[model samples]
Target: MNEQSPLIPTLPQGTPPEDLVPIGAPGGLDAAINPLGAELWFLRDRDGGHLLWNGNPDIWSGRAPILFPIVGRLRDDSYRHDGHVYRLPRHGFARHARFTPGAHDDHHALFRLEDNAETRAAYPFAFALTISYAITGNTLTIGAEVANRGDTPMPFSFGFHPALRWPLPQGGLRAAHHILFDRPEAPDIARLDSNGLLARSEPSPLEGQELRLRDALFEQDALIFPEVNSHAFTYTSPGGPAIRLQTENLPDLGIWTKPDADFICIEPWQGHADADDFSGDIFQKPGVIVLPPGEVWKASMSLTHERSA
Candidate 1:
């Protein structure tokens, strides 16, 4: 992947004005990233085929919002920290906060978000979150670093919510697309109740290592896998190019889509939402990572386009 000087790349149609920055591989992938929430707005393949969802307002106006501070939702949209109660909405506020752009070139881009009055009010932590994207060959690598900049330890969660085109750009029926996990999974899947809180764990939905895709699967919302055995999976149809996603330092997975929608979200999460009965301090929440002060926690996920012959 030869690096090129920064230049203005073509923007996809209907792209909103969100200070989006363009980055592309030599002949593989092209992406437009927004500073607001450090979200990825557009992703296209070598032939200019859209590989990402378009953030259509009618269905779901979220292209690829970065989940932070919390992967899912809190019990009452609030948490306890140092005996005081703080409120944070579902998935945290990083998706709605603007990040400062760092060094960026044609093949890579970086954005950083730091603690402020607004964030501290809800999270009560001094921290810095950096998000980076690099495209090489037919693969796009996304990296994130969370640094605890305060005197006390901080507990938080992080996740990636990239919604790829349901049928993909490779050409196949939406129903034909399925996910092939890297290992045989055996644990029951977790579900969300009517309040979006973590509910009971149901039976496994996998047929060995393959999960057949369908609309009815997501009728109740996201299928949360709190204990998954695979670190990678392939989203593909019967033929044509397939999307291969790999994760590092992320333990959970969530597959979600609105019924009859044209996109599917493959989420890799470090933590999950509070359980339906959970009502304790933030540190006691399940799957939450407690970072020591002055330490950094990192996680990454990459997407590779596997072209068909």
Candidate 2:
């Protein structure tokens, strides 16, 4: 993969406006990413079919919101850093932040965010976060790059939250859809308490190789697998359209959907929310990444659409 990024179209200084970066190859995947939070607004497959959730308000308002600085809810919605407590909202502020749109060369586009007064007040770290989306053939790859630009170390968590159609654009009923793992083994999922923090690891209700989708299955909220045994999985419907999700360098996975909602999210995460009983430093938080000064961290998730019968 080429690391060189194409220059994104820019707006004049002091211009009041909304800018969106569009990137994709000519004959395959095409997508639009919102600079605000660097969120993906659209994804078009080779067949010109949209595979991402359409963000209907009746089901869920969110599209694909990135989880940065944190993946899930924090204990008390706050964390201790250097003996001082910093308050961060659930899923962190990256989803709400405005990112600087970088260059795009048709096949890929980049967006960047840096620590400022607001971020430092909550994160207290000097860092730069860059996100890039690339399309190759029938695959769309999303990468998150975190750099500790300051002289001190930086600690944080990040993840991708892409909500796909429950029945899928390929067509099927929710109950008729199922997820098949590349590995035969089923991994345990940590239950969430009333507070939404991880309760304990329990044996998954999933069957040997496939987990059928059911509305009641998400009544308790997201199904989080802290110890994900499979790096890849194929999401299939009754017939035709399907998508294969591949997570590289990301270890955790979360499958979530609201009760009776039209979309379900397959999340690839680097870290998860803190445990309910735990109240510790952000650096020591479970699944947190501590990058030394001048160091960079990277993780990616790739989605491939399969329409072959």
Candidate 3:
């Protein structure tokens, strides 16, 4: 296969000392982003109640982290490509790498992360990733775009890992909250092995379109739906406010939280961890997206909060 020497694009890099970019809408929704990981560290509802998990280090300190290149763990924290093996930590490097902040305003902000020597060493390819956040009314919309600058096809996965407040600050008992999908869901789902690799298909705990939230459901770790049919779901409790999340171009979803943790992560994923029995090329990974050279792949999700009456 022939390859082209494309001109690599450059942008300002994010420096240390971890500063936060604050954005808010006239409607009262507000957010704070840390460019170091392009992570949304805070989000408040229109009524001034927090809707996102506060990264309390004692528990799980991630608010909303972007997952890319690989969604979950590999068989051995590594992958094979072009006869060479490369290593990537869980959820890939995007969550830990710096992203250069770009255009911004009161309610919108854009940040970019491009492949560098560090990235190429781990996953040999030229690519650019941009993440944008915007708030309008009571909704926060997040957009991610990945462009393959190499002449050959680039195989990768992307996902959004957002940990919203468990009881959602709108006033509800933790055990009272549940998830309502847009459609009835299947009874079976995928699970992970003790090693965190994709294990096997098992019976799902969901009952029709609803999944009542509880700590016991997570005793074995994250519940993954590799074949989710709904593009939207609502997180709420009876008579409480709700957070409705909508996804675009994301086919899989995962729900997880540390038992009794104050937050629950609703993840919309384009790909997942490697199956325990499969260890082939990166392109062969399940749910991976192959983007042709010079092409861009995009995915987005929106979160709308409904205030309690």
Reference-based TM-score of each model: 0.95, 0.91, 0.93
How many pairs of residues collide in model 1?
Answer: 0
How do the residues 1-309 of candidate 3 rate in per-residue lDDT, one tens digit apiece? 012201111212212133677788776688878898899877877666778777777777788999988999999999999999999999999999999999998889999999999999998999999999998988899999999999999999999999999888866799999998998778899999998899888888888889999999899999999879999999998889999999999999999999999899999999999889888999888889999999999999999988876
Whole-model lDDT values for every prediction:
0.89, 0.83, 0.88
* Top candidate (TM-score): 1
Query: How well is each residue in 8-106 modelled by candidate 1, as lDDT tens digits?
Result: 234334536647788997788888889999998878888878888888778898888999999999999999978899999999999999999999998
Each candidate's number of clashing pairs is 0, 5, 0
Give the clashing residue pairs of candidate 3, or none.
none
Per-residue lDDT over 20-131 for candidate 2, one digit per residue giving the tens place of the 0 to 100 score: 5777776777777888889987787766667777666665767799888998999999999888999999889999999998888888899999999999989888999999
lDDT of model 1 at residue 191? 93
lDDT (Cα) of model 3: 0.88
Q: Can you list the residue pairs that collide in candidate 2? A: 6-103, 6-104, 7-103, 7-104, 8-103
Worst 10 residues of 1 by lDDT: 1-10
Regions of model 1 farther than 4 Å from truth: 1-15
Q: Is candidate 1 or 2 superior in TM-score?
A: 1
Minimal lDDT window, size 10, model 2: 2-11
lDDT of 1: 0.89
